[model samples]
Target: MSTSDMQDANLQEALVTYEKLQDIEDDMDEVEVEILRQQDKLCKDIYAKRAEVITKIPQFWPLVIEQAPPDVDEYIQPSDSALLLNSLVNLTVERFELPQGDPRSVSIKWEFKENEYFENKVLEKKFWWRRARDGWAGLVSEPVDIKWKEGKDLTGGMLGLVQKVWEEEKAGKEGETEAAKKLKQLMEDTGLGGVSFFAWFGFRGRKISAEEDKEAFQKEQEHRQARKAGKETEEDAMDEDDDDSDDDEYEMEIFPTADDLAVCISEDLWPGAIKYFTNAQEQDDMSDIDFESDDEMDEDEPEGDAPANKKRKA
Candidate 1:
């Protein structure tokens, strides 16, 4: 064969190998789903017990939120933290649809005591791990409504702006409409990327109906099966590009980063809440010790020499 013929053969060989690898990865993902289901079953009672104990501790959930990982803490501004510390009483994450619909679906319930922040006693955000169009599947959630008291809104009007954009989209406006531009401008003006972490409750990432998602998901599965069996039709080959192109459209979402934020909550914030609280305690203790040591050193040294020391440090 000529050199060109050999290159063509190599390209074809590479494509076949890539399809085989994708098939294996898809199978691994299925196993992962089962593992998640089993993990929930194993941890249900443990989480329930912990929930009972932690709720008794004053500000347990509040401190957990206050000392959350950077990815989460960045959302909890001082104002938002104040509301949470004052009102947030208990938080629980559960597979609300486990063994019924999707095991991966979680309801993160935030129980609030009576406070000036809002009227609702409990705020729950459910993240449904449903399949969407174009073989894409991840956590998608609807925004929860947080009824704030007059002049107590922490999200800086972001939730309302997002709702306006959604309303416009529902009313037939699409693709970076005027409302979306305003939403984007509000995010920039807030300088927090997402206004407040509390605004996360109002994030709506995907816009497809359940019926459409289900139909597309079925077609995606069929396409995957065809690829795995090396029975992909010419039509399937053409549709492959179209499927990938839809993914880029998600970036235009009003809350494009919300999906990543969701992962941080489910994986790091909820799963490791106790650990974060413990870490906060440890850091506080260390800070106290350091402060004491600094005081002792200050006393041992002359106060008049502080300026000299500062000059030397500079």
Candidate 2:
């Protein structure tokens, strides 16, 4: 070959080699870019997943807490008299939810304020579930006698006691007497009116006389029946007039329940209180997600993606 032709051939070969090398380098660059993009996406996804879990973990309890009314610190102050009063009030308020259903049965907790007392008595308080029209109702029992021992967690035990009280009240086992029923009904009505029975009576352990209570109940029933019967006959008219003359003869007695006492002392407390809590249903489209999955990201994703595919961590 001629020198000019040979030189041209060598240059052509070098250009072809350089072009091939450039193509390979471009492919590698593209692959590396793709890998880096995937890694960045994975890191973002992992971070989002972790954040979702943390957010959900605190959600359930906060929802429950939100439903409850704010605490009344001044009203809940400790005093020998106030403690006893609060005990009664708390018990009475607790009863309002009694005829309804169980809130305290699930998770019962109690907290007492420090340095508040009536006279020289230490306050005792508790919280428990009670029944309501909506579902389970929640109650924070006012301070009672603090006999809770050290190292002996009273949460579960107190729950049991509340359950027992609930059963007894439900079965009409504890206070089946006519007086008790009348007292219960009165307390329920009064509680709905924003009154607490505990604030009225300062001390606990006061027993109503069964005989007196029964007689008083009977008198109240007679009065109600009389009112229902409407006016009086001509012959009985004179007797009616006589009864009216002695209108002040029948003294009105106030019989309070433990629940009543609670409501009374609390004093218009629990305003706008929610009656109960209920469980909500999951959506049909979301059914594929395992209800028990610990990873919220896995649970929250749309159903269209590969059902078993674990998204790369961000």
Overall lDDT per candidate, in order of appearance: 0.74, 0.35
Q: Among all windows of ten consecutive residues in candidate 2, which has the lowest summed lDDT?
A: 272-281
Give the Å error, residue 262, model 1: 1.5
- lDDT by residue (1-314, candidate 1, tens digit) is 99999999999899888888888898998898788788888888888888888867887887788788888777666777888888788877787777756677777878888988788999888887766554557777776777878987777777766667667767887577776777678766666564666777776656556786679768877878788678853332346665565564453344567767777877788879899889878877877777677666777887676522321110
| Residue 19 lDDT (model 2) | 53
TM-score of each: 0.81, 0.23
Residue range 220-294, candidate 2, lDDT tens digits: 445444444553212112355544533421111221233443443233332222221111112222433544452
Clashes of each: 0, 46
Cα shift from native, residue 55, model 2 (Å): 16
Q: Pick the candidate with the highest lDDT.
A: 1
Q: Where is model 2 more than 4 Å wrong at Cα?
A: 1-72, 77-93, 96-144, 147-202, 205-207, 231-261, 264-314
- The alpha-carbon lDDT assigned to residue 133 of candidate 2 equals 22
